[model samples]
Target: MPADQLTDLLDPARWDPLPHPPAMEYPLPVRRRDPRTLPPAPATGSAPEVLSRGADGVLLRLRHRAPRARAVALHASGWWRPQPADALDLVPAGDGWWEIVLEAPADWRTSYGFVEHDGPGDPPWWEAGLKAPGAPVHPDALCAHRHGAARGGAERSVLSLPFDGLFRAGRDDAETPAEVHELPLGPDAPRVRWWVPEEAGPAPLPLLVVTDGAEHVEQLGTPERLRRGVEAGVLPPLVAVFVDAGEHRGDVLGVPGGQARWIPEDLVPRLRAAGLTAPGGRRLALTDDPARTIITGASYGGLTALFTAARAPGTIGIAIAQSVSLWRYPRGALVGPLREAAGYAPLRLRLHAGRFEGSMAADARALADALDGSGAEVTLDLHSGGHDWAWWQPALLHDLAAELGR
Candidate 1:
């Protein structure tokens, strides 16, 4: 009756076909006696090697042990004012540190660190390691520093159209929403699996589309989180589209042209023909202008969110990238799209990574630096844990109220 071909929606291996660093489920503070920040990479500990640089920006190698704190603010102290750029981001190793790039004037001084209301759960941001005897926390802020690292590159809009052939759906049929559905790209095509939420009733509802599919659901427990966002008004009552990854995730995500086809040739048309996508419609171009639509994932999935926005600027609005592994593809795949990307119809991005996600920080910072350089409306947060979910959950809820609603 309702696509019997779709079943076994929670298969992790089947969903997250690409390899993305794993992340924690929440962010809890680690009570350390001596609070000190790790000085500089090339100076104190091992910093990643610099790969290449151009007028666009410098591309530094990533150090798996780098330390990047969570929920930092670029305040008056000069945290991000001493570099060739004006922002920073991280790739978490979930180990002892995270990879990040500092952007500000070569000569600058400022204070910053993790920020959170001193209350119930855990402070939103905490400086894990700092050692400038009397280094002084913002007291009102975090930590201060003189001089920022040189960073950033050319800015551009990317149309994320990775299509080795890949990748949502409906509300009205949701009265008792089908938990799983097998959607064929065409009338006589190979059927791919689509996991629908158990939410009932069709009515108009927002949507959350996940690329890594099952792994996102299991590791991040997104279904539960989305359910909560809905109930709490952090997000509109929404329908979720969990697409199980087929062999081509990287192939599709690593390239751009293919992406457009996947959605146009395969994903989008199918949803429209099925009559499931009414609110967000069949593609990014058709999504709501003011309505909140979020697309996210870890590693490749995270990368795809950036790609998706580049591909269909006005289609979707909010994007969350967790431990996005940009290096998994080529710099151009990300850069080229971002450079040419347009239609910045008020899109928002939330990026997160464990303090130690390894070489992947290159991937993390590239996007963050790009977003900040372009002056795109974006927010970046980091946590103590490495690429694990224990940390991802906190970033999700912290911004829930802001992104979803009241």
Candidate 2:
């Protein structure tokens, strides 16, 4: 398509915006739910408990008294990476109470939840309880240190191991309210949210476009991270545009055709119209310079971030793709072709995936290596965690600071 036609195709007022595409399939680690029927565990209580171990370890004990559960397993961040293990399995005790004691690093701060399997041929139940088809399950509500809802519809229990001054521990130091706007991408297109630093100067700010806007804000605490980074002098002032995934997130983020074009061509203009980049506005300067703009996301959104940068070369300077879906099983696979492509735009990139992400981690490394061969300044980090928010939150802060910090 001609560049002019591509730009016209994304004119939200003239277009209904493309419908979200189908979901991509990737190999997520199979969780191990022991099929043995064990006696009920002792009834300790309903609330979560944490105790300090010797200097570096923290003991985490959880109790659940589900009578029909054959085995109760705990799912925390970084626990189920690489392969399935019985370490998180709660030991059966007493008549109905089941418990699992985990000795974790003292610096751990992540969310968790329980899965109760009813033996073979039965599905497991999450802490969100039972719900009708298509209903949302709030995972944060189930946690002992519940903050708010998380991404992907469900929530998890939070665990902040005893640590002082850890980067991602506890609540955000401050909060900034965001302005929400509906773009004309499609009738069903999700609304995007805009956020500026609470205390920015008159200078024009760089633009940071985040895919999966709602999840990043409500679940992963993106605004708070931005706030903390700015307050700590780790990041420059930037205007953030958060795009929502809606029900068709899989289609929207998984495919590059629609979302890739819509963001820079369509949504960005809308931002400008809102006086975000106007001379006397919030001063979000839209530019063709790659260093002044960043696009970021996780999982399928991560894949979209890379696709967006690749598709809109001069438009997006930095791409932060966290836990990108690089596998082939899903609809949008980029590594193979990206490796073979002769030329690419001069885009600085940061790629992150959990070390426990199994094949996905390998894919991230492969993509980074290919980018390196292509002479792209790419930073690939395989952190010590799973494809969970526990890892993505910290990765976002680190990437933003590394890419745009002054």
Q: What lDDT tens digits, residue by residue, belong to model 2 across residues 1-406?
A: 3344433333334422244344322223432233233333234333455643677565555666667777666665555421333445567765766776556555555556666676574333232222211122223322444433344456565565533222362244244444343335567556777777757766656788988887766665667667767878888777888888777766677565557668876776565555453224545544445677888888888877876766665567678888887662343245433332214346677888875555677878877875667645678877655566666766676777777853
Q: Count backbone overlaps in model 2.
A: 11
Clashes of each: 71, 11
Candidate 1 global lDDT: 0.41
TM-scores for candidates 1 onward, in order: 0.47, 0.69
Please provide, for model 1 over 60-134, each residue's C-alpha lDDT reduced to its tens digit, 9 standing for 90 to 100: 323333233432222221121212121232434355444444322211112222221323433222232221111
Candidate 2, superposed: residue stretches over 4 Å from native: 1-71, 77-86, 92-98, 103-110, 116-152, 160-190, 269-288, 329-345
- The model with the greatest TM-score is 2
The local distance difference test score of each candidate is 0.41, 0.60
**Among all candidates shown, the one with the greatest lDDT:** 2
Lowest-sum lDDT 10-residue window in model 1:
161-170
lDDT of 1 at 277: 37
